[model samples]
Target: MLTILLTAIVIINLLFIYTLVKDLIKHKDEVMSEPASTIWTPIAQVIIYFLSTFGISDFAISTALYPKAKWVSMKKLPGTLNTQCVIPVFVMALAYINSISVGVTTLLVCIVCQVIGAYVGPYFVVKLPEKVIKNFVVVGLLVASLLILAGKFNWIPANGTATELTGTKLVLTGLLMFVYGALNNIGIGSYALTMATVYAMGMNPAAAFPIMMGACTFSVSIGSMQFIKLQDYSRKITMMSVFGVIGVLIAVFLVKSLNTQMLQWVVLVVLLYSAVSLFMAGRKESEA
Candidate 1:
C-alpha cells in the first residue's frame, strides 16, 4: 500500500514537471526576454516540490507501519504546514549571513544566538555587527566541512532516531534546531545541519529526513508562492522547478533507498565545492 501511494505521487510529480516544461518551451518566445533563465530551473523546482511531498508522505507511511508513539500526534499537520512557510525565509537570511560572516563557527553561533536573543535575550544583541556576521559564516562553513569529512570517514556513528533524548544534550539539540529553523531565512540549508545534529545526538538519521523535508517543503511552498505573487517568477526558476520535480520523483519512487555512506560522501563533496566557491567569490570581492 505504501509503495503504491508513493508510486502514484511520483507519477503525479513527473506529470507536473512535464506540463511545466512543455508550457515553458511553448511560451519561450514570450519569456525569452529573460535570457538569463536556465533550461533547468523549472525542472529543479519541480523536483524539490516532489521530493518534499514524497518525504512527508514516506514519513506518514512509515509511521503507520508501526504503532503510533504516545507523543506523536498526527493532528499536527495543519500547524506543521503553517510552520513550513517560514523555512524558505529563514534559508534566504542564512544564505546572506553566510556570505558575509567571517567564520563559519561564528556564523553557526550567531545563528543560535540570534534566535535566542530574538526570543529571550536583549533586543539590541539580536542585531549582530557586520564584521561579526562575516566571521561567523566563515567559521560555520569550516565546521560544516569538518562534519562532512567526519561523516564521510565513518569516524562518527550514523544512527537513526531510535535513541531517547535527555539532559543537556537534548536541550542543546532543540535549541540548535530552533536556530537552524530561523537561519533558513538567509538561504542556509537546514537539511544538512539537521542531519548532522540528529546524527551527533545518536538519533535515527532516517527520522531526521522526514522532519527536514517537511520543514523545507513548507517553507519553500510559502516562499515560492510569495515570489509568484510578487511577479518574481521567471523561466529559469520555472525550468528548475520542472527538473527538480523530475528528480524528486526518480529519487523517491524509483530509488526508494540509497546507501547512506555514499550519499554522505556525495553531499560532502558538494558542500566542499560550495565552500570553495564561496571563498573564491569572497576573495574576488575583496580584491575588487
Candidate 2:
C-alpha cells in the first residue's frame, strides 16, 4: 500500500510538471517578465519541503522569487504565488493521505475549520496592511520553526508517537488550522505551523506530513479562487508548479538514502532560512 501510494505521488507530480512546462513554453515570449523566479523559486520551495515539511511556495517567493519577479507587486504577490501552489499542494497532500487516515476524525475537523478560514481569508488579505501581514507571517514561521528544531534534537520533549488527537487536543487543532488557513492568504505557509502544533500535541512527526499537506490542500485550493476573483494574482511564474514536483521527487529519494543526522541538519538549515528570511523581510518593510 505504501509503495503504491508513493508511486502515485511520483506520477501525479510528473503530470503536473508536464502541464506546467507546456504552459510555460507556450507563453514564455509574452507574460514571462522575470525568468529567474521561474527557475529558482520552485527549486527553493522544494528544498524547504525536503528539509522541513514546510511545503510553502510563498516562502520561496518572498525569499527567492519575489526579489526577482519585479513586475509582480508585493500586494499581488501573495495571491499570485498561491495560485501557483493549488496543484502542487494537492499533489503533495495525496502523497500523505494514507498516513493521515488513522486520524480521519481529526482531519475532517481541520478541513471544516480550514474551509471557513480559507473562504474568508482573501477579503482580509485585501484589507490588511502589508506590515501587519508580514509581521504575522514572520512571527508564526519563526516560532514554529524554532520549536520544530528544538523538538528534532531532544532539546525539547517532542516527536510524539501518537497518530491522532482526541478531545481537547482535537478541538484545539481545528481552531489552530482555522487560523493557519486564514494566515495562508497573507503569505504564511501552514505546513510547518501545523506540524509544530501536532508535534507539540503529541502526534507523530511522520504523521504531520499527511495532515498538514491534506489540510492545506483544501484551504489553498478554495482560497486561491478568491485571489483570482479579486484580480490580485499573477500568472507569469506559474511554471514553478512543475519544478516543485521535480524537487519533491528528488527530495524523497535523497531522504530515503541519507543518514538521520545529515537529514537533521538539512532540516535545521532550511527551517532557519525560512524563519530568518521572513523576519528580515518584515523588518525591511517596516523600516520603509
Candidate 3:
C-alpha cells in the first residue's frame, strides 16, 4: 500500500512539473523576469538531489526503525497533541512566513508576531533586533535537541497506529487537520511534522505518509498556482519544484532502505547549521 501510494505521488508530481515547465516555456517571454526566474534550474536539481539523497532514504529508515507500526485511523494524535495542534500549526506558520520574507529582521519580527498571535491576537509587536533573531535560532536548536532527547529516551512514542483512535480522537483530529490546512498559507510543511506528531501518538508511520503527502500536495498545488498567477514564479523555485519531484522519485525507487538514527542525526545537524546561517545572515544585514 505504501509503495503504491508513494509511486502515485511521484507520478502526480512529475505530471505537475511537466505541465508547469510546459506552461513556462510556452509563455517564456511573459514570465522570464519573475523574482524566482534565476533559480528554476538549480532548484529543480536540488529537489532531485534532495529526494534521491534525503526524502526517500528518510522514509525507508522510518519504516525500518518502526516495522511494527500500525495504521492510525484517528483524526489527530491520541491525546493532548491533538488538542494542541495549534502549537505546531503556529510554529509552521512562522516557519513558512520566515522562508519567504526578504530580511532577517523582518523574519524575526514575523516570528515574534506569529508566536504572540498564536497565543494572543496580533498586537503592537515590535520588530525584532538582530540579536533577538539570533537568540531565537539558538532557542530553536534547543527545542530540536529536546525533541531528539525525548525520542532517544523513549519518553515519547516515536510513531502512531490507527487503532489508537477513539471517538474523541476523531473529532480532534479533524479539527487539527483544518488548522494544518489553514496554516499551509505561510509555507509550513505540515507533512513531516504531522507524521512525527501522529507517530509520537502511536499511529503507523506508513499510514501517516499518505495523509501528510495528500495534504501537502493539495496545499502546494494551490500555493504554486497562486505564485504562477501572480507572476511570483522564478526559475529557481520552478527548478526546485522540478528537481524535487525527480529527487523524490529516485529516492523512492533507488534507495531501498536507510538508517533512521543516522538520518535523524544528519537532519539535526543540518537544522543547526541552518539556524547559524540565518543568524549570520541577519547580522550581515544589520551591518549593511
TM-score: which candidate is best?
Answer: 2
What lDDT score goes with residue 102 in model 2? Answer: 43
Candidate 1 C-alpha lDDT tens digits along 1-288 = 324423433443344345445656777786556433344334334434443332222111211211122111222212222222233223322222222222223223323433442232112212545334333444444555576676677777786545345667666865776675454432244555766776787776654554454334433343333333333334433443334445455554567654555544544565455556546656776799
Q: Which stretches of candidate 2 lie over 4 Å from their true place?
A: 1-30, 34-65, 68-71, 99-101, 152-156, 253-288
Over the stretch 58-142, how does candidate 2's per-residue lDDT look in tens digits?
3433433453446466667677656667665665676567534546677677777886898899998888776675566566556
Which 10-residue window in model 2 sums to the lowest lDDT?
52-61
Best of the two (2, 3) by TM-score: 2
Task: List the candidate numbers ranked by lDDT, top first.
Answer: 2, 1, 3
Looking at model 1, report the run of 10 residues with the lowest lDDT sum.
58-67
- Score every model by TM-score: 0.51, 0.73, 0.54
Model 3, residue 119: what's the lDDT? 23
Sum up the clashes in candidate 2. 0
Could you give candidate 3's per-residue lDDT for residues 1-288 as a string of tens digits? 334433544554455456567767878775545333344434434432343233222222221211122211111101111111222222222222222222223222222332232222101111234355245434444455455555667766755545234455544554555554433332222444454555654655554443444444433443443334344334323433333444444445565556667666765665556556556656787799
